[model samples]
Target chain A: MRLSERELVSLIRRKLARSTASEGTIVGPGDDAAIIAPTPGEALALSTDAIVEDVHFRRRWATGFLLGLKSLLSSISDIFAMGARPRACLVSLGLSTWASPLFVEDLFEGMLKAAGRFGASIVGGNITRSNKLFIDMTVTGHLAPGNAITRAGAKVGDAIYVTGHLGGAALAAKHLFGGRIDRGRLAEVESFLRDDVAATPGDAQVELLSRFFAPPIRAEESSALAAAGICTSMIDISDGIGSDLREVCHESGVGAVIEIDSIPVFDRLPGSLAINRRDMLRLAISGGEDYELLFTVRQSDELRLQRLFQENDLCPITKIGRITPNSEGIVFLDNDGRPSEGFTGFDHFSTKEEGH
Target chain B: MRLSERELVSLIRRKLARSTASEGTIVGPGDDAAIIAPTPGEALALSTDAIVEDVHFRRRWATGFLLGLKSLLSSISDIFAMGARPRACLVSLGLSTWASPLFVEDLFEGMLKAAGRFGASIVGGNITRSNKLFIDMTVTGHLAPGNAITRAGAKVGDAIYVTGHLGGAALAAKHLFGGRIDRGRLAEVESFLRDDVAATPGDAQVELLSRFFAPPIRAEESSALAAAGICTSMIDISDGIGSDLREVCHESGVGAVIEIDSIPVFDRLPGSLAINRRDMLRLAISGGEDYELLFTVRQSDELRLQRLFQENDLCPITKIGRITPNSEGIVFLDNDGRPSEGFTGFDHFSTKEEGH
Candidate 1:
């Protein structure tokens, strides 16, 4: 059932139960502005993103509730990618004049649903008028003296790994475009996708698909990995492996020679997903919005990482490349040992002509 | 004249000379993921807004640099409105293909300039491809104990006051629509608008416009306002006096009786300005995005508030309204003692049709 914006806000409030705001939460929600405590040494993390009507999704493809959920997830995902647990998320919505208060409520419901799952609360946000339905969210997280992680931590010879499979979201996008659903086929596909719903033992394909649609991961894993002394540098694989990896490499002042053959790809997948084997590498390399953690570890720590994965039943850690001096730049080497041409992973600006 | 995104980012980084995630900045910038500390018992004040192409601005009216600056200001303004000092900000930009790295950088330049003024730092953000220009930002602030202010704090018999004058931005916006540079009259306009640029008087009007388009007035004044024990409740007039006051009253579970004539309106603006008095009042009441503080003082604290203003050389605080029982709701009475039928306040969603 579709939820109303008010209902959604209530749900989000429920999830925000964990945030105490230190007895300084003079006003939490249900107000135009929320009151908070001010600390001299403390700093805040602020960020915003918009999910446009046609650009981000189709109204007919998903309920307003789902769209709302995705909108919250999209920005919160950025917060998570920053390696901070979400403390609060504020939304500024743009709605069509014809939209009812209920529609907005449903959008909030979707957002609250997602937010509830992540322990973040919606403190305060704005609703603006617009010709289109736009969902924009800004999230804040707290990081004390030495807890936050950044992209420049990778060291030379650090092992690279990912939390989930690469292309299932892309596959889901294809299925969404076709608007066809077969439970029987879906179940079979789920076996390969492993949606991380409960983690019933299935083949790698179901796990991969599940990972793509809903990557099973959290910030807790970063702590776990950190406690194990395994991660050297890290990133969330929102864009495919290549693009995301390139980010880590570039920021860390390292160049990597990745073996194409080492990349994990789903071959037993059905339903005619767009990326082929060659393109699969590309998708794994560049398809954005994965939300899986991608990190590098010193080669010496690989054993510890493997043990953590074994104990946690998280996705396997793979060694794809190493961090080298920036003098080498970032290069993708094939199995035969040659450099490839044309490696612009994704540019939001350059693709405007194609309408995103 | 425009700056590149990279160059802009570099400039912004330069502007934020002291902002270091150093002690706890695990993940600064240029990373797919940033990690931060999660301090317990601290509720966060978070807000997000988007300044979209065509929706929020006219490219010709505002430079790419100003657009960037405004985007950052909008986010920071939310933080200030909460009476919270900014900690960190995240930006997610969807750029049109026509925009170059230079153009993106210029936008960042504007944002950095604003950020520098407020001491807020850009910690992390994203870049993506889109058909239109979209700048989304989230700002998070920390509030210390007993310092956070909320609209719900207002009590019955409380007096209403605002930080700056109203309607000037609306007037400026109207004049801007003509797009004719009256260079000969520029000096007059600049001097007249001097309050907005912080070159002259520190009254409601000047404070209002400055808060609208520039870095927020932080720390000392707020601390002084709190220390002097004047405000019963406070809110930044992001929306105009009418709507913002409505929010304060509604949240406080009280109704308000506003004196239409008593509300401060900008005067001696300009001969060519050609703005109507009622229109100016309407703009002051209905026009959004002022970002000035709207606060209430208990009757007992009125003298203190006056002394505070006198001490600061600020404009005298005008008594525009009174908080009443909720049963009365919001009532705006004019000089003739007639009841108004409608209020033209801005609802982000409702105002979509207003040609903002």
Candidate 2:
């Protein structure tokens, strides 16, 4: 049932109190403001992101728990991209009048789960009523003094790398939004997956959909990379590889030539999904919401970086390309080494509008 | 005059760049996240607040610039209440499709003005499209290590004080919303005031309206109090003195008795305003959005606190009440010194909905 604003706030405060305060939390929730003890000799990192209903996700496409998880993860990804360790988060939620208390509880549960996983605390937040649902989160992280890895540090001859495979989230979004698959078939698959029954041996589509619904935040992997001091530049692939790579290039005044064959794509889908190799490659290049770490490193450190990943048992790090001087722009080199076209990625306000 | 998302972001970034970065800002905007160096041995203070259209304000009630200023000020006031110095702010704006580029720019201009006024920089933010306008701001502040003044520090016999005269904002809101004066009268007064023509000698309504539209944030006064170690407990009067006083009492396990004659009320208004003393007292006690500082100090420090405020030329501080043992509860002693009933204050989701 819907609760009064005061009741809702009390409920949220109680739910959030379940999260143990970290060492840096001098004052946790329930005060005029939270006080966090600074990690001495470190610089603080701050980033904010918002997820609005229909703008970012539809309630029908995911559960409240998953939405909350994704909202916090998306904001944390920005901190991770900066090679910082997230310490605290402040969530500002705009709730619709129709929202039930249970729904809000589930949302907070998801957020707390994510925060606990990252070793951060939900220090403070505000909630207000609105016509639509929106969750705006601000995350604070920290790194060693003067040791932040920025998007503006990529250099010529740097090797490009990305953690984990891409395209799964895009493909899942396609199915959820009825891009190629019929709505009835998509519903059937979703229902089957939600029923908690074991999927058939060849049902990779369910796995893809799960990944899209609850994408992982690469905090551990990013921390390892940052601690190693190996990355020349870094960013999280929230807006697809092409768009994020362009950001790195534009910021660093460099270009890149990525080998299409070397770019990782989800390949376990059954043939029944009717997705061809070309479409898969296109999704990998242009689709967004992967939440993977993309970074550039000096060619000399490439081997050492790979060894570091292996030693830490971190996610697979793939060498996808090399940074070039600004003249070449960003190019996609096919298997035969010929530059290919149509490497555009998602833009929220592009002329050709695409649902996030 | 609507701008694309990218253009709007670029405009905001350019405007924010006018705010010089503090020494603690290691990396500013245009990166994955901004990096800040923490003051050594200090604790970080954080607060998030949002202003939602129709709920918190109406489009016709104030200009976009005023709305932006109020939003930032309200959040910063939380930091001030905690006896912290605001360092930076991250603003997340949800703009309706109908909002013009000029409207957004004016909003940002006001926010920047407020940030600059408090010596806090707009370090980073995010903007997204929504069905209604909402500005969610998160402010970061700092306090001397272990020196934060909390709402739970008040002791029995401590004297309570407020920074400025009250009821002006509440009176203004009443006039704007046709509480006693009709809408047409409010419109006429607003027009007269906006025209920059001289108000007739008895036009106290105009003065009240102006105060309501631009209530000041008591940052300087709060900082001075914090630095001097005078306040035992503190809070901002965003929800009126009664409500905020109740908060402090509840947190500190104390009770209070406020003298009706001692409570500051705006008395400069002429009879044309049509507000009686009873209504005026009610407004002062129950009206929200005053943005004044309500603090408690030990009885021994009261005179010194007043002298310090006067010496610093800070906002006028008035003694309003005295803290008592929790057994006494909170009482309002009328002019005749008799306890009064029905001292209810504003609650956003109370059964009796009060306009904010």
The candidate that achieves the highest lDDT relative to the unseen native structure: 2
Q: What is the C-alpha RMSD of each candidate to the true structure, in Å?
A: 5.3, 4.4
- Against the native complex, each candidate's DockQ, computed on alpha carbons, is 0.33, 0.62
Error of 2 at A100 (Å): 1.8
Superposed by TM-score, candidate 2 places the C-alpha of residue B8 at a distance from the truth, in angstroms, of: 2.1
How far in Å is the alpha carbon of B6 misplaced in model 1?
A: 8.1
**What's the residue-level lDDT of B161 in candidate 2?**
91
For each candidate, the alpha-carbon lDDT, in order, equals 0.60, 0.80
Give the alpha carbon lDDT tens digit for every residue of A302-340 in model 2. Answer: 888988988989888788999999999999998989998
Native-referenced Cα lDDT, model 1:
0.60
Model 2's CAPRI class is medium
What is the alpha-carbon interface RMSD for each candidate? 5.6, 1.6
Highest-DockQ candidate? 2
